[model samples]
Target: MKILISWLGKTDIDHMQVDKLAAIATLATKHTAPFDTVLILANAWEEHWHDYEKWLNKRLAVISRPAEVEVRQQSLSSPIDYVAIAAVMLRNLQALCQGDNQVYINLTSGTPAMTAMSVLIGQGMYQCHFLQAAPDNSVVEVRIPLDFAATYKKAVSTSVRNKVIAGPSLSSEFSRIAAESDAMKAALNKAAKLAATDLPALILGETGTGKELLATAIHAAGNRSAKPLKTINCGALPENLVDSILFGHVKGAFTGANNDHAGLFEQADGGTLFLDEVGELTPAVQVKLLRALQQGEITRVGDSKTRQVDVRVIAATHRQLATMVAEGTFREDLFYRIAVGVIELPPLRHRTADIPDLVKQIMAEINAVFSKQPDYKSKKISSSAIKFIATQPWPGNIRALWNALNRAVLWADNTELTVTDIQNATVDAVKTDESSPVVPEFVAGFDIQQYIDGIKENIVKAALDKTGGNKSKAAKLLGLANHQTLANWMKNLGIAEQ
Candidate 1:
C-alpha cells in the first residue's frame, strides 16, 4: 500500500518538528516496505524556499527509503499568502485520488489548507486511510471510506452517547486490581475480545479504575505475549522528552544523551507498547506518531538510518479523547484510529451485588499479608462488619477496599473483625461523617410526629439533590409511596417548582 504524507509549511521549519517528521517517514518505510511512498507537500515563500528545501532535504535523507520520499514545495510571494498554494496542492491530491494504487493520507501535522484538502480527498478516495498524529507524538491510522460519511457520522454520534452514558473503559492491565463486580466482569470480557484482534484499542475509565491493568491483560493474551511489555505514561513525561523516549536517540543526539538509546518502539519489537494517559501527548508528538503508525518504522534521534519494528499498541486514558479532539487538544484522525475497539469500565457504585465476594477475598488477602508466620490463619469477619462495608460508598473502588481491609487487619486484636473496626478504618479514609451527634438520647416523651417530619424532610432533600431536583425521579429514587405524597411534602415544605 502507498501512503502519502502531505503537510503545509510556514516560512521556516522548526528543527525539532522536522526531525520528528523524518523519524515518522523512516518508521513508515520500515513497516510498509516495497509498496509505500511518502509525499510531503509544503508551501514556501520566495525568501525561504531555498532554505526550506535544503533543510527538508537534509531531514529527508535520514529516512531509510530516501528514493521513495518526494518533497514538493510551492512558492508564494509571502509566507502568509497560502490561498493559491492550498488550491494547487488540493488539485494535485484530487488527481492522485484517481490512481489505482491504495493511498493513505496523514493529516496529523498538516496545515489548515492541508487538513481541508485531506477531507476533500477523503470524500473522493474511498480506498484512502486517514492517519493523525497523537499527543504522544505517535501516529494513529483510521480507515474511513468516502461513501461511509453517513456511517462515520452515525458512529461518531453513538461514540459520544456512549461516553456520556457509560464513561470511559477501564484499562485491561489493571483489571486484576478492581473489585469483583458485574461491570468489571463485562469490561474484562470486552477487553478479552478486543485483545484477540490486532486493531488499536482505546481504553477509557476514571482514575484508579485499572485501565492499565486491562491494557496489560490484553497484551499478555495477544501474539506478542513472549516479548517485552513496554509502557509509557504520556502524562508523566515532559514535551521535549516524549519523542526521544518513544523513538530513541543516537549518541550525542541531545545534552542528556551520553550513549545511543533504542526507543520503546525498538524495545517493543514483536511485543506490545502500552501508552497510558495518552490524552496528555502534545500535537507535535501526535504528528510523528501518526506517521510511525501509518508506516511501521522509526529512526533513532540524530540518525537517518531506518529500522522496522512490529509492535501491538494498546492505549489507556481517563480523559475524554473525543472532546479533546473536538477542542483541538487531540488529533481527530488519531482518535478514530485508537478507538476502533473501545471498552468502558463501570464505576464500583453501579455494581453493588458483587461487594460481598470482593470483601471476603480482600479480607483473606489482608490476613495472609499481616501474618508474620508463613502459616495462614483463618479469621472470621463479623456479619455486621460485612453489612457496614456493603452499605458504605467506596469511591476509591477496589484500591480503597484493599486499604480499608489492611487497616482493619492491623487493628483486629483478635480473630474476629467487628463493624466498628471496618467503619472506623474506612469511614475516615472516605471522608464520611462518622459521628452520629449522640441524638440527645431520644427521650421517651419526645414529639414523635415532629421527629418523623424532620427525618422525612431530610430524606426528601437528599433525594432531590441526588436526582438533580427532578421531582418525579427523586420520588422514585427516594422510594416515596407515590407522586402525590411527594407533591404534598414539597408543598408543605414550601419547596417551589424547579
Candidate 2:
C-alpha cells in the first residue's frame, strides 16, 4: 500500500552537474519497488510538464513496476505559495495513503518554500517518510526533528497514545449561548473539537459576534483549564509594548522596565494563550511568534536564553487574514501556522430565530437587577415586541441586541414591554453624540446583497401584515413596479404570500 510523491523540476544540470530527474527517477525505483501507485507533484505551468510527467511514468513502469502514475499540478501564482503547496501535499497523502502504506516524499525538487512546507506538513501531520536521491544514484530517507513534540519523527511506525484534553467542548457557557442557525451550530461543534487538540485555532467573526466568548469556552473545555489562560490584545499594544507583553522582559530591560515582567507567553506556559485581534500584530512581533512556534520556546525581551512553553494558541480577529497575507502585511508562514484550524462565527442577524429566547434571558436578568431597587419593576416583552426586534438588521450582532434591550427595558413604563417602548429605544440607540457623528469604519461582515434582500422581505412582510394581506398597499409601501413584482419576489424567495 506504499506510494511515492515527487516534484518535477527542470531537467537542466545543477551546480553539481546532476540532473534533478535523475534523483527523482532513482528515488522512485526504491519507493515503487513494492508500491500500489505513484503521485508526481508537478508544476503544470512549467514548460514541457507533460513530457516530464510522461517520462517519469514510463521510467517508473520499468524501474519500479507500479500499477498507475498520476501527476498532481500546482497552479499557484508563484513557487513561493507555501499555503497552496502544503495543502496540495496533504491532500495527496490523504487520497493516496493507506493504513499499512509507507509514504515516501522526494524533497529534491520543488521550490525551497515548497520543500519547507512539505517537510513541515509531512512531519507534523502525515508522518510520511522523506527520501532524497544522491548524485551517485543512492536513495536515503530524510529524517526531520521536531521541537514541540520530541517523539515526532519522519516515518515513525510506533503507535502512541494521544494526550488531548479529555472533555466535551460544549461546556455550559457555549451551550447557554443561543446560536439556533445550522451554520452557527456547526461552527461551535467544530470549534469544540479544535479546542481539545494542540493545533492553533483561528476564530473569525464580526465585532460583538462573541469571538472571545468562544475562545474562553474552548479554554474551559481543554486539558489546560486548570492552568492560567492568558489574553492579549494585539491591536492595542505598540510594537515595543507587544514584545514586553508577549515575551516578557528582565528587570531594567528598557527605560520603563522598573521590575522583571513575565510576558503573556511565560504567564500562559502550560496553558492556552488567546491572542485577540491577531491580525493587528506588527511584522516584527509576527516573526517572533513564528519563531516561538517553530522552536517550541521563547526568550524574554532582554534575555537570550529561550524558555520552553507548552502553550496552546487560540487567535481571533475580524480582519481578513488571507487578504492581509496577499498584501504582504501579515507573514504568510505565520498565517499558515496559526490557521491550522479555523472557525467563522455567523452574525446574530443571520440567525434571528434565537431572538425570542435571548429576549427572555435578557429580560429575566434585567428584572433580577431591578428587584433590588425601589419603585422599579421587572420587564417582560410581548410576542409582537420580539417579532419587531427580530426584523431589525443587527449590524453589531449580539452586543448591539443586548444594548438595545437595556434601553427598551428602562424606557418601559410598566412590567409589560410594548412595541412603542422598543421603537423609542431603537430611535434613541440610532442617535450619535457630537464628538463621533460619522458612520463606523468597519463593515462587520455586512453582505450588501443579503442585506438588501432581507430589507425587502421585512418591508414586504411588515406591509402585508399591517394591511391584512392587501397586495396593493404592500406593493405601494415597497415601491414595487406593481403587485405582480411583489408576488414574484415572494415566489423567488420562497416566502408565502398569505
Candidate 3:
C-alpha cells in the first residue's frame, strides 16, 4: 500500500527512465521500506508509456519484490504547473493515502521546475519523504528542518495563491478587512459572488470581526456600488431613537425636534442600506424594519404617510439572532427576512495563520496615520516581532491586534518595533485598565488621546453645572488662569458653551 509519486522525464533527456533508478533505490533501502507502488505524471512526450511500463516492470521484477504501477498523462501548459499539482495532491492524498502506508516523491528526475515543485509540495504540504535515484546506486533522503514559520508554509502558499487570483486591488481591500485566512476567504468570496443579487445578506461574526467592512465591500462589489451606501450602528443607538434615525423624523416630530431629517433608507434611496449589529435593535425597531423589508416602504415618525423606496438591505450582527428569536426578544419574521444569505466570519485566533499579513497591513496604515502628525513618528516591525505577535491568542480579533500595534507605533522611538515594544504596549493597556473608573471591557479599545479629551470635557461640564452655568465660577473651581482659558479648552475639545 506504499506509494511514490514521480514524474516521467522526457526520453530525449539523459535520464530516459528516472522511475527505474528510483525503484532500485527503494528496493535497496535499509528497512523493508514500503515502496510498493508508483504513480507517474507524464506529458505528451510519453507517446509510448506502455512500452516504458513494460521496461519498468521488467526492471522492477529483477528486484526482491514486485510493485503496483500506474501512469497519468497530463497536458503541460506552464513552466510552474506545480501550483495545480500541489492542489490536486492536497485533495487526493488526504482522501486516499493514510494508515501504515508510507509516501515519497521522486525528485531526481524531470525538468528543474518540476523537481522544485515536487519539493515544495512534498515539504510544504504533505510532509512526505524525498527519494532521489542516486547515480551512485544509493537512495538519498532529504529531510526538511522543522520550525513554526516552516510548518505554516502550506497555509501561506494557499494564502498567496488566493491573493494572486483575487486581483491586486480587490485582494488588498479584502485582506485589509479580513486577512487571507481560509475561512475569511470562503466567507469573503461567497459575499462577492452573491453581491450582485438583490437578496438581503446576513453577516455573522464576533465583535471586531469587520462586519461593517465586509458589508461595505459586498455593497461595492454588487450592482449598487454606483449608489450611496448608508450605514448605521444599531447597537449604539437607544430604543427611542432607532425609529427616528432609521426611518426619518419631521420637524417637531418630538420635544427637541427642530428640522426634518432623512433617514438611512431615504438617503440610500436607490442604493444599499447596511445595518451593523442588527441583532441589537429593539423589538419595536425590529417590527418596523420587518415591515419595511416586506412592504418596500418606510413611514416617518409622527407622519402617517408611507413613502415607497427601493433600497437593498444588508444586515450584520455579532450576536446570535437565533437565540434571541427563541427567547422572543427578536421577531422571527424579521430574522428570516434578513437571513436570505448568511456568512459567518472566523475569529482571529482561528485565523492565526493570517496574522503576519495582518501585521504588515495594519502597520502600513499606522505609519500613514503617523506621518500626518509632527510629534508622532512612524515605526516598522521586525520579523521576530511579527512572529511573537502571531503566537498570542488575540481574543479581541483584528481590532485588538490593530489597537495593540497602534500603541506600539506610538511607543517606539527611532527604532523598529520589537518583541519588547509590543509587550510594553500591552502592559500599558493593562495599567490603563487597572486605574480606569469603568471596566476594561468597556474601555479596552478606546484611543488614549480621545479618551482623555472626553474626560476633560465631562469634568468641565460638571464644574459648570455645579457653578450655576457661570464661566467665572467654573474656572475658579477648576483653578484655571481665567474664564477665557476654560472657554478655549472647551472650544478645542469641540464642546459648545452652555
Winner by lDDT: 2
Q: Candidate 1 regions off by >4 Å? A: 1-181, 372-380, 431-498
Model 1, global lDDT: 0.68
- Pairs that clash in candidate 3: none
Report the lDDT tens digits of candidate 2 across residue range 106-139: 8887678878887887777777888887777788
Q: 62-180 in candidate 1: lDDT tens per residue?
A: 56344355566654444343444445555566666665766666665545655665666565445466766555545666655446567678898997798679955545444454446
- Model 2: ten consecutive residues of lowest lDDT: 154-163
All models: lDDT? 0.68, 0.75, 0.73
Task: Enumerate clash totals for all models, in the order shown.
Answer: 32, 0, 0
- Which candidate achieves the best TM-score against the true structure? 2
Error of 2 at 149 (Å): 14
Measured against the true structure, the TM-scores of the candidates, in listed sequence, are 0.52, 0.55, 0.51
RMSD of 2: 18.2
Better of 2 and 3 by TM-score: 2
What does candidate 3 score on TM? 0.51
Residue range 1-498, candidate 3, lDDT tens digits:
677777766531223345434433343232247457767767655566776666556666676556666677754565466644554455445643578766777776566777776666666656577777655656777675654355588788897799689884453445446456788778877786668588899999988877888888888877788999998888887787878888898888998888888888889987999998998888777877888888877888888766667788899898999999999998999999989899998988788778888888898898898789986666789998887787665657788889999888887785599877886675423222223466424565768777787667767866665454789978987789999999999899887778
- Which residue pairs in candidate 2 have backbone atoms (N, alpha carbon, C) closer than 3 angstroms, thus clashing? none
Give candidate 1's error at residue 95 in angstroms: 18
Residue runs of model 2 more than 4 Å from their true location after superposition? 1-169, 369-372, 428-498
Alpha-carbon RMSD to native, per candidate: 17.7, 18.2, 22.5
